[model samples]
Target: MGRHSLPDGSAPASTGSRPGARRRTIAISTGLVLAVAAGSVVALRSDLLPFGEPCDGQSVRLDVAASPDIAPALDAVAKTAREGAARTDGRCLDVKITPRPAHEIADAFGQRPVDPEFQVWIPDSSLWVDRVDAGSGTPLTTAGTIASSPIALGAVPEAAKALGWPKKTYTWTELTEAATTDDALRLGVADPARSATGLLALARINAANAKDTKDGDEADTRTAAAAKLLYQRVADGDGQVLATLPRDDSGAEQGNPRRNQALLLSEQAAYAHNTGEDGGPDLDLFYPQNGTAQLDYPYTLVDDDETTPAQTRAANRFLTLLSEPGGQRALRRHGFRTDNGRPDSEVVDAAGGREPQPYSADPADPPSVKELQALLGMWTVTVQSARITTVVDASASMANPVPDRGGQSRMDLAKNSLLQALATFTPEDEIGLWKFATYLDGNKDHVELSPTNRLGDRDKDGTTHRDALAAAFGSLAPVPGGATGLYDTTLAAYEKACGAYASGKFNALVIVTDGANDDSSGIGLDSLVGKLEKLADPKRPVPLIAIAIGAQADKSALDRIAAPTGGSAHRVDDPSQIHQVILKAIMAAGSKGPR
Candidate 1:
């Protein structure tokens, strides 16, 4: 994601031996000779003299913004450097370490034309660096990583015993299921939107679920279910999630409904809590059999034209000091892995990790930007209620049979996918249905079959809105001799969705079609797109999520139509993938705010 690659798990190489007394004397003699030859009236500063000279009054001060979890350790290292009078290019180093959350710093840097107050940054993961680089802001020069910690599930002693933490090694999927399905476990996680530890852990869980299941729908279902469960007990960040744990070691406190018995946490965090003087219950860590995601504290330089050469050298010098023996010892004492990411047995034992657990396993690959965005989007929609109006094409070609779906028609697969997607929505969400075919509505290309209403609402016949929508989805059939009216249907659906925009809900339009527009008499493509652009309002965004279903579908046209509303278009070769596409599209759009 950036120009600098992550550390390759190798120990830091030696920079070379210090200058000997003879070498220092020769350097001093040489400096005096040069000064005499120059015949200058100005007196030289002490720092310009020799290697062992005392620092002058002008010390280079560098402000460092470090993630809270690692700040104290870095502070200790800074203190040692200050006391030792660490110097770079003959100038004394005065480094100030500030404890700030990684997300807060990332947000600040993500803005345009960032003028960061700090000269250096050490976020919990390189993911934050990627985020800042993705934005239109001042670029960062990554020096390297300082420390690392793998993400794991932390459970109280009682809960750990129940799950057989040390003896039973479970994959991420199995661990998630055990935590979410058992009422006694009371699992919680830091909000993915705020915590890298939380987001990375969730991504690993999703990847594990996908790998274990052959059926895409089943995988999606499992992932969504786990997200919902975690959402119900989500904390604001790593610190907050740990605070949700039982305060005391008593069995009664462990069973408290208001407290969480297990949480998604980093090994360092668990170690801090377990060894803190606060006298709280200790946490036993579970390293997933599948590879663990790690928090690699990357040391990044905030580079700009305003930065002085002295400050740059000072920053690089500080990074070098951090990888040295003294700095490594300090990091280990604070419960962090060294830059190489190799597990230290003492640190692992303190964090409640045991042998046979995959604590030393290689770190999982970092999630891509697209994957992270989609995961956040899904988390947002799953936690928040949505108001979606889905429109389906009922053109004559919809009856075309899928290649490997046991003779099932495209319509059949589409309907089944829609129903599966419907189940993921909460009752608080609002949903509606529409079917479109040329001349099917006696002049209009699309007709509304169900009004957008809360899924929990019931009619006089005691039928829930969810039930009605499901029935409507199942009833969708191809109109005999009908043609695709994609352009007109899209315009009409978007207009209606915009008009009935639900405040504080993920209000949007979803369109599913298997072919390009075949009705030339209907509105033209350019005209439809122009109308949608005119109607689209950023304040009340009703993004148009278009899904093109077969080889005959026009993805390019759909993309143009979707662009105006800040929505996206997706094409799937098999109709059975419509549900996954819809979920991913929803995630992509939802991450862009209300849309």
Candidate 2:
């Protein structure tokens, strides 16, 4: 739109001289400027331009952060949308795609349960939509399809044959028995805590809170009962439950071999990565010989202060695009079911090689505030896990060596780091404080210290229960006990952080520990992991971050806990580094995704 004057006396063109056609040139040039401006204006307005067209040159960026389960499909759809928008409106559409597992989808946008900042959230189910609504007070305003393959079990042909896939329906008994008795028949599902499919599968097993009526044809499920069932089964059985995953065609990438051999995830997710296209084996799918639950990936809206109207608009547009023909085709290619298309043969085959079952999802389910309350209620109980409770070693071995940096006693550095870590949280972050090293009873018992108010339960002005949090982290004086119960304490910390808090708050469990597992006092690590395995939430996760100090720091164990819980673990090489380590722990805990 910049202006330019015609050079020389072009105006003289009007005065004879083959300067003829002067009026024609002026008219043509003027037309081009107006045309370009009009085109730009039109381009600026559309988000999805229809099929076969390029993205608009001026559309706002439609950055989509999707759980990995649906990212591929969405990315393809977005690209098509960009093309269409461009062709129709002469606009530009730029798309940025990031992938994460389903559980972390909520955290990508908002600070609290009710908030999300992304233009769109494509989690694996309407269940996620419901959970967020409970916290944010509505189904994320943006709408998206709950399009997904039925939640089913995937088994290799040989495994299916052994499990009696076609002849007998596969039941919980089959899965449990395989886990307990058949070491070679490993079961796979993403970690329920991090993946939606895992959580959904657990819900099915626990008959998850199936509504209970006082005396009607009552089949109501109690959340506690379900938790007990799931926790007991996994904790008691030797199942390979993966917490995080390796990204690859066959998922054959190396990891801590002890963690797991298989994963828990949606049937579609399994298909997308493990099938022929990935140049891997032809995975067989089983609908568990049981009725399948539909996994609806809902497009949600984040309502926290961080949300903006553009996000809403972009999200809405994205939803519309998903339903459009171009988006539909792309979703189909990625194994997503469509309103108008053939069932994905891959999905059909893995579904126990059976016909696709009927499926439906209700995104309009009103958010239940009580559900949020219920999830929150679980937090407190999770914290009091029996797995936690370590033995502290106050032996002569303790005082001699230091954790090196700037020469502070290992214990002193750990304490200072913890204190500094506490400050990293603003009033908004929910932090559960716990301190070990001292036994309250002469019998050497670990104390819960004190409890702090729940996160997001703060007053309108945003003040939290500061005093309780302070009391929990009061001191770390070692008591007259055996060696430090590093393993047991870590176990206990896991339960406290993931188990004790209420839902609807950011989960950050920061543990400061010094050495080996010899001083076993609290719950054992295996038992603690057992409890953690059953952990579920329609909302946020209870993240655990730890800092190891002293010459005796058990960095390996700490690292294990942090990775599975979506946090970090570090060894403070020097006393001066403790503060930074603590702050990092706090930040890592506050962060969302993975663990």
Candidate 3:
């Protein structure tokens, strides 16, 4: 997926004598003779041999799929192992290293059919391992971590000086704000959807802001603001983002709009750039004072039916070899920290680290899966303009008071939550509103309160579309003697969304209800689901995100109808949680690629 490509051959070598076969043969024979002369007959045993005997049995060959950044170093160690005839259970070990982007491999594993060509996976971070585990894929056994690299902000000398780097230490928030708010320091980042380095850094920033704020909403607002700023200068992936930096040490090139002054990257990446022969300006690294997220390269074993006992043992042996001092030194030479989390001063210095920087400080705790998902959700929404048609239940039961919201009715809380959620969207996003209840409109169960339009669009009165939507949301009230008409309203909204599908935009229908479908005269559940299934198109998807409010809501029915449209159903005990659930659902739907 990047500059690194697979080796000349895609398959592992056959089990046999290797290039140094003659030398191994000589050594093995001499060792046996020496043992015999010493009168230690038992030393001739394969297990007891001081130096392992040449493989009398078949060699155990393993294909290793490693992250691109670490593949070259691993290949070196593997080559050494091959020349030295590394062995497990008297059999020689042969490992072939292939450099692959972790995200591509993760997507492969996420699909059906539990089959993988490689026996071992060494992604740059354990986050990929977690992603695989979260999906329905072949199980992975993580033996241990092999290397580590901390995420940091890297800036050219000129930009670093502007931020008072090397002498002034700033927390994640302070550092990000200082860099992003300045026109002179244009910050760039790899898309969080693609780069762990970017996502982890953003999560760290969120966590740091959360500690300084009073609640989750405030923290989310601050993080979203930062995300919007970053989206303006985002790149697709690590390699592409790095390519955005100035090509030379000239001020003219540095001021180019296409070149980035600063970027979020791993320490090892910075080191590589500084030490490369490209003749570009070296970056000055800043390890946030709040702590940095680390890329813990976990050595995971792919346990599938194709795996053999010998291969398993060989995988374990290779892991042991990687943890040895020789392997650690090799990794350090490649600008990575060993598994013990100790920073190499040489590498740090080469990466532009100085005394005031917290390069050697303990890594920040890894973000939880949920936290990462939420961050991704926010990123997805912030980066892409959405076209959403939201339908809220206007049944009489909505007048029921919420338990702990200072006697606010369910309708009040729901409207307020929707307004709060609306604030998260940008002016480019298109949104509309509908209120539904049986017979709310003449011979219909749903009525559009606001027509879908870009939030920035202005009417004859000079009122923005966003203002109109907000006013409509505020005017929402339960219809007198109205009954739930979930089935009819959902179908109508979904059909409208699909018919007006905004190509290249995140188009979807959001239905929020506090009760089950009560309009029996409308389309049956089976009929509605069938129509949805027929309308669902992979090329023009319109996922129906259904949110059930309170204990009285029918989540099962919502789930059934949602599933056919590549959507999902969620339940919230409190209406105030609708905003969060909506974002999470958007994340989930957006991630289901091509479906």
Count of backbone clashes for each model?
A: 0, 56, 0
Best by TM-score: 3
342-451 in candidate 3: lDDT tens per residue? 78899899988998798888887788767787788777777788999999999999999998789999999999999988988889999999999999998799999999
Candidate 3 C-alpha RMSD relative to the actual structure: 8.3
- Candidate 2 stretches with Cα past 4 Å from truth are 1-48, 51-56, 85-90, 105-117, 136-139, 173-184, 208-264, 276-280, 303-314, 340-343, 350-352, 355-595
Ranking by TM-score: 3, 1, 2
- Checking candidate 1 for backbone clashes, the offending pairs are none
What lDDT would candidate 3 get against the real structure? Answer: 0.82
Overall lDDT per candidate, in order of appearance: 0.81, 0.46, 0.82
**Stronger candidate by TM-score (2 vs 3):** 3
Alpha-carbon runs more than 4 Å astray in model 3: 1-59, 88-92, 399-409, 460-462, 537-540, 570-577, 587-595
> TM-score of the candidate numbered 2?
0.47
Flag clash pairs in model 3: none
For candidate 3, the 10 contiguous residues with the lowest summed lDDT are 8-17
